[model samples]
Target: MGSNMLFVRDITPRKVNFSLRVKVMKIQIMNGKGYDSGKKTLELIVVDEQGDRIGVNIRHVLKPKFESALREHHHYILRNVVVVDNPVRFRSIHWNHETKLMFTHKSTIIPFESSQWTGPEGFNFLQFSDLKSPVLLKAGVTADVIGRVNSYGNIKQRGQTDDIPSKFINFELKDLSDVVVSCTLWGQFCIDFYNYMKKAGEDQCVIVLIQFGTTKDYIGELTVSSDWNFTSVLIDSDDVPAISDFRARLLELHANDNSVGSLAPMLTPPTNDLTKWFKDVKCVGLDDLRPDNPGIFVVHATIIAILPDEPWSYIACKKCNKKANTVDKNVDLTLNIDELLALERYCKKCGEKPKVQLRFKVSVRVEDDYGTASLTLFETQIQNYFDKSAYELQKSLPEDQDQPDELDELLGKSLLFKLEVSDFNRDRTYANYTVKDATTDSQFIQVFNEKYQTHKAGDDSYSFDVVKESSTSKVTSSTKGDSTSTTDGSQAVDLTADSDNSPLKKRIKTEPGTSPMSFSSSTNKPN
Candidate 1:
């Protein structure tokens, strides 16, 4: 400890005031305050060099004197502050007493350089293993976590109070040891994180730092969510050495020929049963899809139209796959600091100003002889359908063009889709068919061939050879022996080995301006 540093444990509730220099870990404004007050009550999480943390609340009247000068993650010198017992309900730190910094005419505050700290200060990040530790399992225990995002779920609204529902995004995170944990961001935290990923450009690989997060039971498993108004999120932040080291570690792993897919198994892969699951389902034609019936159905269709001028993707709610719009549009954007302070008045679910992210929202029109319909496809299915990530497709385009040809290439390809019908409203008059999964497997292709009978031997039209894949083991077949079956329009049909056994999107495209297409099947050992 520095000679001038004051230990937090030594501070006790007293009538007389005291002074201490501490780093402001975070500051959050409370909600429901009128904008007229010049001073706004704010909560602060501060820590000493010894890693001791204490909560601090600046009274509303004293806020004007200190709020503008106070910056998070910065060291501050405080004078004439009273110490009191921490309110149990609002405690953000473990310390027994909280500092009450007031704005007396004589009060003094000094902002010092960040270089004063010898190393990363004020954070005690726990490992994924720590979530199950006995101490953390006890009530009121909280800590920080740093990890790489493995996969993210959709953002959804959860009812918190009778009046307002809180928004959340569920995501899986992995620590350096490759231990995976489920994490959810609540309220504004969800909005902030979703928007952060959008602007940062780096997707799954970026390291994230979570502070003041608390643990809870989710689906009978331990999970973490941002503690109200206390938790802070930083994505790919280099200010912390742990984050910087994590970035280097990822680079090193990639350099060593360790692919990010090495962690793919850690993810709960789509089950092999998905094939049998698809087989047992009855297939429906595009015209047969009805708002009158709400059920999951299988459909073999070809993309007939790509909606023009629509950005093929958007950042969606991790849970719902709906566009994640700003949490609040009512907040005044003209004022600088006051607008930020005003955000605290709304409940976490309503959000002060939620951020929108980019997720896949591919809209395509599909058709069969029975009928044609428009369908919406979100991230997971889109990734499966295209064999590419929405982020990759989005980034590959030139800045001037919003509609990439990569998406345009999806047109005129035959696919089998698991369609889900969910009514957006109660009437069911406006139900939409969402593409749950899209694949070019033998089963779907055979169904298309049998139902449509669009392909003929004499015609230059292409036909897919039936492929039998076993769930438990790898399978391979040769293209050399099948040359006689392939027509001039038929390209080499090589089915990539997929360990999960989910069919890959291998479509037969025409040679520009021609509808004639062909498919030949050759399989390789599953990778």
Candidate 2:
């Protein structure tokens, strides 16, 4: 205790007279991005004896002077610190102020031994139910959120900041009330979230506490992204005292309510956002694809040979995915699975000729320096690259050949493939390595390579030293756009092949909804 000891509530801007004693509630060590690249910054949120907290910024030059002395949850006394108006627009909802502290040349942090502090660790966590309130959601403020991890999707990449690309991964955080708040995390935060989830596995409890996270109105849906540089992430680690209480209460809530075990393994990753999905699936070399593992992983490889061993087209059900005996007379597709099943259109065990759609399933051999594997492309990849649906292609080609010779054009062409290794393939029940998606667009591949090219020091972490994406017009692989663009919904430039003999002779896009039954070819003659 000192005569000049100051509480956080009484601190003012540009003050240098008082010595303040506070508990280091949290400390974040992060590498600088954008303009502050190559420099490291230390951010801390310290709480006084009364539980009032203020953020502290330690510059790179003065970081070494106070780095070792600051320990989270420990008492420290600061003297001659510079206080300034905080520039961070969005701050923690409840525990926030207009001013923040900074380190000066004379600033010092001394450990205090004779501690009389008996206060909470200053985490003003926001409730999940309150996330829906217009005042909370619409207000330009940061929030502290703590909840059980429900599910997470692949990375959602948008733009580059100072040549380093920014990424977002979305997941749901469920509180004890069964209320869920969607979270979008960036950079190292995303890495740590999965790191804890992977370590916790399916049986253990994995609760998280994000301090000073951001809130955004993403197309009317509320999402919270942890602040990029300053956000403090507390996962299942025992170092933080709050996690024990959170874990216990969450468990007791479900247990007392008679809900059996810990809320874990809802693994329902999102799929609707194709722009985020197709490219961000984990990229793996051919050697990395294990037979025992079953998941969608990307492979950047060349089309070595089109395996002529399987039929490229088969009669398929329009109402569902089941194979039909022959073409159905009625093309009136029942919208729902129940309605289709009620009308005797969909069946797994029985032979039913539902309104037929021509299925395009082609097996192609792909190879890179790592190894070689057989990959099968479905209808979307086939039509987009070939500029024709399975039905139209079937109508145009000669009936005698199993597949047209033009398919040979795909050989030697490089593609980024989204390969799905299912349990069937793992169990040897299915022979082909199926591709969920594939793209021939070079710009998309450049971004993919930058993201997954090199693994960082930690598990599942990526070296995101990405260059700014080409803003010039692109021939992207996304097809959900207009007739000129490709599948995954990314915009691209006008299509053109390299030379006269290029495999990409006609770069017309074939969007997903191109009906297999809606062919415009009039005669029985081949096109």
lDDT of 2 by residue, 52-159 (tens): 778887888777777777777788888878877776633445555688887888787778763466666567777887788766665446777888776554443342
Best by TM-score: 2
- What's the alpha carbon RMSD for model 2? 23.7
Model 2: number of backbone collisions = 9
Report the Cα lDDT for candidate 2. 0.59
Off by over 4 Å in 2: 1-5, 14-16, 26-42, 59-64, 105-108, 138-142, 160-165, 191-205, 219-222, 232-234, 238-240, 256-262, 270-527
lDDT of 1 by residue, 339-390 (tens): 4433433223334334333455666767665666666655544443465666
- Cα error of candidate 1 at position 222, Å: 3.8
Q: What global local distance difference test value does model 1 have?
A: 0.54
